[model samples]
Target: MTRSEATASTTGTPEADEYDVIVIGAGPVGENVAERAHANGLSAVVVETELVGGECSYWACMPSKALLRPMAALADARRVEGASQAVRGSLDADAVLARRTAFTSDWQDGGQVDWLDSVAVDLRRGRARLDGPRRVKIEAPDGSTHTLTARHAVAVCTGSRAALPDLPGIEEARPWTSREATASKEVPGRLAVVGGGVVGAEMAVAWRALGAEVTMLVRGERLLPRMEPFAGELVAEALTEAGAEVRTGVSVESLRRPSTDRPVTLALSDGGQLEADEVLFATGRRPRTEDLGLETVGCEPGSWLTVDDTCRVKDVHGGWLYAVGDANGRALLTHQGKYQARIAGAAIGARAAGVPLLETDRWGAHAATADHEAVPQVVFTDPEAASVGLTAEDAERRGLRVRAVDLEMGEVAGAALYADGYRGRARMVVDLDREVLVGVTFVGPGVSELLHSATVAVAGEVPVERLWHAVPSYPTISEVWLRLLETYRG
Candidate 1:
């Protein structure tokens, strides 16, 4: 059968179909929007060109964590005296690669397809673009087209892509984006990573542990410039200790690779050249809005869509258009994207049912309050760094009356017991005027699990006095919370 005919029989014909909500992109954000809209009695359909699970499920988060977990486990084993003696060999690369493949479901989308089916969200496999307000045009793989109309709202959840710098020969070099890095079958002998952000830092740690001679080129003074300075410092120290050559205050002038099989040669801003088996440019991300046909709806084609408290597109006349997740350019993390999806989906349902949006406050159900008040993220590195809300520097720049309470996490008995020589730091940015934590950061082995407590505190805006009653359990890494609180009180 023809592609159009098949689509009509399987997913319903464009002329005969209309949904209350149409979500572009079937990633976690898109999936959540469809699921939540369904929960509110709205008929929703999700259009996707790739795997429904998106980057996190296939390439970015799941695969990367699967690769990092073994390395972390081995490191901890080596740190303890009794376990250190039992360790005698390096990581099994083949086994590690196999586990990573399993975690990503071998890059298949079947599981995610089943999830959408269970949630009663219609799935259309196509590249979707905004044909006009509340109208989406989708191009199928076989060069057929389908038009979908949204009765209530069209949500942009297409997320973002890895951004490469403008440089000659870089594109032809076939450099490793985050996709290739995490899902790589063969480890590069020498890897050059440019950019000091989360991707750069995490990949540097992962590849170096997996036996790649990683050279990190950071244009800034340190890695993770977005986080607190101490967080970056500790990460740099860990990367250096892992035998990765960490270079700061450097830039790539040009790149040259005559063929895909050839090593990539880089000409540095310092008038030096280095060659590597692979080069990953994890500089940043750009919204996947280039081909969304935003111009037809009176929105800029390649720019981010502005959204209000309800995630409703600001400039659209009838407010039928909304943008969520990385496409909104608010918080780029997956969890934050899911949070926005919940808010945007509910808002669409409310509008469809002719119900008023009652609670639009900072922590309200109809508004993505967590995106502004408390966005939590955990960087999976040895001595993992997890943080939520603002850093001290961010609070100062925002002109908020905040005080930073910094302490060594090693002083906590739980941390010391967790590892023979626990080396890490903790910091809390307290809103002195409100007597509550505005931000919190923890960097140490096994510290990623300790982050949600801080997330709850910041999101709930729990007062300092009330927090004192919420005692952390004795003899756990979470005791850092108690230490931070005590330091603040003093």
Candidate 2:
């Protein structure tokens, strides 16, 4: 049958309610899962309650980065000699918001929907939940309901939602989550950010540049508690230098907002009070599985699902239930989720064909080894911090014999030429037993582009001796690689 005919037969009628794959959520991860399953000769249908492109497209990644770019460009220019002299005015907040809206296509998902149609993957606009093993029930917006049975597998890709802290009068305060913080159209005069994670740090930087008096309240001793100590230190220092207050070891005990037009009053655990036009709680995220009908399949609702290397959920009796992306509680990054989806899709196809699962070993076509060994992340604060694989602390905790080598990025020629007074750091954690890079980190201007090479080294497990033969071009930040190698040798 033709692709369109196949899709119609699978989703057009109540009698024809079976597909090779039933994917819940239409975010990037779910889209990839459906597309890959269809490519592998399986009919697939995706169910979504929100935009097809999910959080990254409309709110988190794209819009947030768009809002950040203008400020970053201006900051980069001021770091140079001739450019600094030419730099004159502050950021255009309205223009920044417009550009951000443009990136999200003004919060419309038509383009994404069209792309799905072109791929011949069926789309159902609704909320989905597991009825039982391999069975999914969708509740459409117009109060219609339909049930779909997966001949092969059901994949859950519902990502995550912002988790708010339990404090007195928090709900009444109606504080901003990451969604509100990224999608806001206006710049608040005085913005108070609680939590010093990636969301908190990036929003503080973006809003401060957009002319807000930004204050950061951190419950921990420092920001980015999961990354290396210096990463948070550098970001905190930069935020402080940029006229934002970074208060560590403080928490919001309570919040009060008398009316919509009034500012928010926060009672602090340190026995102080502060007021701000808006308060953003970037505390954490919880899996979007609370109402996903996990209880029907012997799993708890609202809890993260555990999966194997091939993304198969362990709690389910049959191997037909899979959970990808944030729902699996693995790496939460969009890129990593898509990677898992690809592997999971292939595994489902191979099993249905009654063929041996292809190369189920580490780093194989059916394995998601990267989720554990070589996950990479980039935080886009000024002097962006990027890291791949493990951190020094992670390595030590894992009981690996490792040594961390560090170098001042300013000492590199390319860095000096890039910025007048370059201030950043680079570190590589070497596994002593294997003589390979177990982890790598770079914190400096324009270092986001340097992440792939680190990811390659860690994922490929390139030996230190072999790395010596791979030469770096002169007068580039990548030359920091040579410096790192030299430091490791010494």
lDDT of 2 by residue, 107-134 (tens): 9988898888888788888889899888
Predicted candidate 1 versus true structure: per-residue lDDT over 1-490, tens digit per residue = 2222234323333555577788999999999998999898887888999998998899798999999999999999988889999999899888999999999999988888888887778888889988877899999988989788888889999999998888988888888899999999998999999988899888898889889999999999988887888888999999999999999999999899988778999999999998999999999999999999999999887777789988888979998998999998999889899988989888888988999988887778898888887989998988799999999989988999999999999999999888998999999999999898999999999989989999999999999889888988889988887888888778
- After superposition, the stretches of candidate 1 with alpha carbons farther than 4 Å from their true spots are 1-15
In model 2, the runs with Cα more than 4 Å from the true position are 1-15
In model 2, state the lDDT of residue 217. 97
Note the residue pairs that clash in candidate 1. none
TM-score of structure candidate 2: 0.97
Clashing residue pairs in all predictions, respectively, total: 0, 0
> What are the RMSDs of all candidates, in order?
2.2, 2.0
